[model samples]
Target: MTVERTLHHFPLDPASRQVRLALGEKRVAFHEVAERYWERRPELTRLNPSGMTPVLVETDGGKTLVVCESRAILEHLEEVTPEPELMGRDLAERAETRRLLQWFDRKFDYEVNGLLLHEKMEKRLLGLGAPDPANMRAGREALRAHLGYVEKLLTERDWLNGRRLSLADFAAAANFSVIDYFGDVPWTDFPAARTWYTKIKSRPCFRPLLTDRWPGLAPVAHYDDLDF
Candidate 1:
């Protein structure tokens, strides 16, 4: 039985991007449905009561399964399609991968995205006024700290979790890519992190994210440049 898959997501959403990267890396065929989740469309809410993006709906002939949010969807993908696993193989590796996943989804999102994305992308989409300079400054500072941590990790290992590419890489990349779109990442100051990013950016799965553009939002000139 062939399983048909459809993903509901927002173009610039980090969570959505994570799912997309996982699907692409796993070589899974799925359809994309872009959603403006902030609007809280009734249809979207029906799929996921929380009204978040990155919902995955899978149908195998008659039966259907709906997975909501990035974490659940990512775990579901790994469980259903074990080949080319994104989670690490061993227990320690898997634990580290999950820890980083939480770090990005919680700590990173709170310190960085909550302030930066809210001021820049959310405000523009919702027709709010100009970005708060104080918030932007704080976000940038926090981002540099995060990048320094990434550089440290890269110095020790090949990938974020350890030796192999894992979901941790996708999580960090998804968040960084969005910030990079706005030309905010201080890549020049973080050579190791830049090198790591360059390697992932060259991957086939990362190609689609480079091309994502929302109305009224323009990306930095080098956002899509693999060589940049």
Candidate 2:
């Protein structure tokens, strides 16, 4: 029997979803363990001391690759499976792509993720917090600033960082999809950003990811609409 590699990750997690997209792009078959972190799954904690998702466990060999960070897992996947390259094929292009990936992961996520996700989703999942109206409003405000940056990049190039659609696009697209679920993105304010995102969100590899859902939270009507 061929040993199966199980991916222990939350389907709705932006980063975890990125890994699933990457794997799906590569046509890699693996079992999914739908472990959400906000609920504080002990198994995820044990598997990764940092207690994060996107843990790829090679159950057959006991050679568990617990990727605590999303980017680490992405880098690992690029190294292991080079075909249909998501990151750039050359060293310089890959570096530039990674730079943008970090910028999106850190700058964009920090500015908006906590403010909105915490206010709208995390409180319910964390099971102890209440909705902070202030944070939600602030996140809505921050989206304007972030969208400007995305628009600027799209105006300069076809994609965010390099000429090709690299991991940077996936990273940013995932974050945008998360906020879009709450109907938080001020799309009309940034038509260029909206246009660029339309391309990324419509990619074949990203189709399944956009359909992801949570138990109590119904995604906005545009969630699965590729053109929207």
Candidate 3:
């Protein structure tokens, strides 16, 4: 018998959620093991020496196939499942999509996620001191600049870089939700991004994400409403 494929991840993590959303999008059923990412879980560290959430464990021939890192997991899924086509199938299209995915992951991580989420969610989740006004302000400023860059991308084409929606959109939205925690995005400033985000957020896979909450930080009221 082929042993099952399972994913161990923290529920609130965007990178982890990106994989979850991919699983949902592809309609791939896998066991979900909620891993404690903030605290150092021994099992998690044992399974993944890097101590990262979003580890994919595939059991085959009585051996555990361990894969760590978000990008690697994504590619592995594309190779093994090959359905619903998160990464484009063709050689050129796949390479281009990977480029855009990296752009979304790297650019968004540096410019938006660390800038905004480091201030708002990280402090709260890590049980550190209260929010830093300076950090919060910095995040807002950085997010606005990044949003403008997103606008530039939107102006050039419909999705991030191609005719169809790719992992780039999911990657971008995953980061945006972190910033949106602080109500940082001025939706009015970028209509194209706003419109595209609204549509993506309205998807069934995205709905559960809207309901996610930290102890003191529930989502903004409009997050779950889907029309906001």
Q: What is the TM-score of each candidate against the true structure?
A: 0.99, 0.90, 0.90
Quality of model 2 by C-alpha lDDT: 0.79
Cα TM-score of candidate 1: 0.99
lDDT string for model 3 (1-228, tens) is 766889998766778877877777777778988776778799899887889888988898868788887788888888887887877656766787788678767876776677568767777778887877877777678788878888888888777756677777777787777566557778888898898898888877786577676667777666666677
Every candidate's lDDT: 0.95, 0.79, 0.77
**Model 3 stretches with alpha carbons more than 4 Å out:** 1-3, 89-92
For candidate 2, what is the TM-score? Answer: 0.90
Error of 2 at 73 (Å): 0.9
| C-alpha-based local distance difference test score of model 3 | 0.77
User: Which parts of model 2 are misplaced by more than 4 Å?
Assistant: 1-3, 59-64
Residue 8 lDDT, candidate 2, scale 0-100: 83
Worst 10 residues of 1 by lDDT: 207-216
Give the worst 10-residue stretch by lDDT in candidate 3: 218-227
Give the alpha carbon lDDT tens digit for every residue of 20-118 in model 1: 999999989999899999999999999999999989999999999999999999999999999898999899999999999999999999999999999
lDDT of 1 at 26: 91
* Top candidate, metric lDDT: 1
